[model samples]
Target: MAKLIALNKPFGVICQFSGDNNTLSDYVDIPNIYPAGRLDKDSEGLVILTDDGKLQNLISNPKYNKTKTYVVQVEGEISDDVASSLQKGVQLKDGNTKPARVKIIEEPSWLWVRTPPIRIRKNIPTSWIEISISEGKNRQIRRMTASVGFPTLRLIRTKIDKWHLGDITSGSYVTL
Candidate 1:
């Protein structure tokens, strides 16, 4: 089996194992290794690629409860009640989600900016939060924040299980 490689995929890049399509080919240059799970093209973060099917399944499967952490910037100041709701689990369109580890945080000193800046208003305040969830649902963080009133401005994955993005800038990849 090929060795596992951890990649910090930048925004606008697709989570494709192969570069058969023009879109995938244009962004990534890795060969052979396949993505264990996927990050949406617009979401930037840590992604794992490996040839071990069992390891891939363990990380991607919801039943394993492998923790995934994200540093999200939202449009407005997050209320304590909203933070409580996020920790307790908010009702989403799909269903009520699993309770997650959520906390408001200051901007990390090492985080890099996205290629296109998030829309901002001079008068409205914004806040950052770190959220860790066991389930890797589709756009779950976006929906979770929106449900409680503050919509996400930027969402970046900082850690997955024991692996972390750790001081890596956007568009940079480190093999681990």
Candidate 2:
């Protein structure tokens, strides 16, 4: 039988199973499972792990076009122009990103406080936005927000295709 696990990765935890830094093994004890995709140490939210290679590729490969949604807390309030630019596609050093689904959103009510909370600039207000993209480029969400003049203060992946973080607390996992 194939096993799929959805994990709510916490901030400061590395993606891999083995490393000097805190890693998946510290949170997940399953054997023979691998992450379908990766999230940066500074980022939080859903990470899918599975023992099936084909399923991993299906979720992680850009060619499969699995949409991933992120809730971003940015340094400055998101503007109409910034949201438009993200929806129209932002040019990055790697290349032009595919157009994304962008919308200004309120901070998630279920959000947990980071252990080391994000820096607060009393003069600069922060706002949240939701962005959905199909590509899994490294630091893509952070890069995209930065390009739009709103550097991301924190990022959390909320959903991937049909799966979602839902009520899962940080560092918790659900087997499917």
Candidate 3:
């Protein structure tokens, strides 16, 4: 049997337990464990790690349609057309992504600042949005917004299915 570990990854930390110096090893020390899914080094929030291969596959595999929700702060207004396009699916260089659930949202109640804040232009407006996707594509949220002319400023994953960051602060780990 395998135990599930849920971690609230802080910004600037890599997903791997070991590897580059900029990784999770510096925070949590778990032997023979690997992350079930990845949260980009620049992104933050709930991540799962486990020793169980079966459970790892279950979480990482897109076939499960395990929806992951992210709260993204972007550099410009989120137009209805862009919101609709994201819901329909954004065409990426790799290919068209699966449709996503996107909506304007207030800043998360439990929001924490990322280590290094995202780049900002003094004149451009910014907004918060919640985007949920079944497929864990690389830089998908950033690319999707850029494609629609609103570049992402900060992205934080709030929940993945039943797992959520909740009150966990950056670099904290909890066993469930």
Candidate No. with top lDDT: 2
Per the 3 Å backbone cut-off, how many clashing residue pairs does candidate 3 have? 0
Residue-level lDDT of model 3, residues 93-116, one tens digit each, is 999999899998877777877668
lDDT-best of 2 and 3: 2
Model 1 bad stretches (over 4 Å)? 17-28
Model 2 gets an lDDT of: 0.94
Of the two candidates 2 and 3, the one with more favorable TM-score, higher being better, is 2
lDDT of 2 by residue, 98-169 (tens): 999999989889999898999998999999999999997899999999998999999999999999999999
Candidate 3 regions off by >4 Å?
Answer: none
Candidate that beats the other on TM-score, 1 or 3, i.e. the better one: 3
Q: How much does each candidate deviate from the true structure in C-alpha RMSD?
A: 1.9, 0.7, 1.3
How many clashes does each candidate structure show, in the order listed? 0, 0, 0
Relative to the true structure, candidate 3 reaches a TM of 0.94
Model 3 global lDDT (CA atoms, 0 to 1): 0.86
- For model 1, name the residue pairs that clash: none
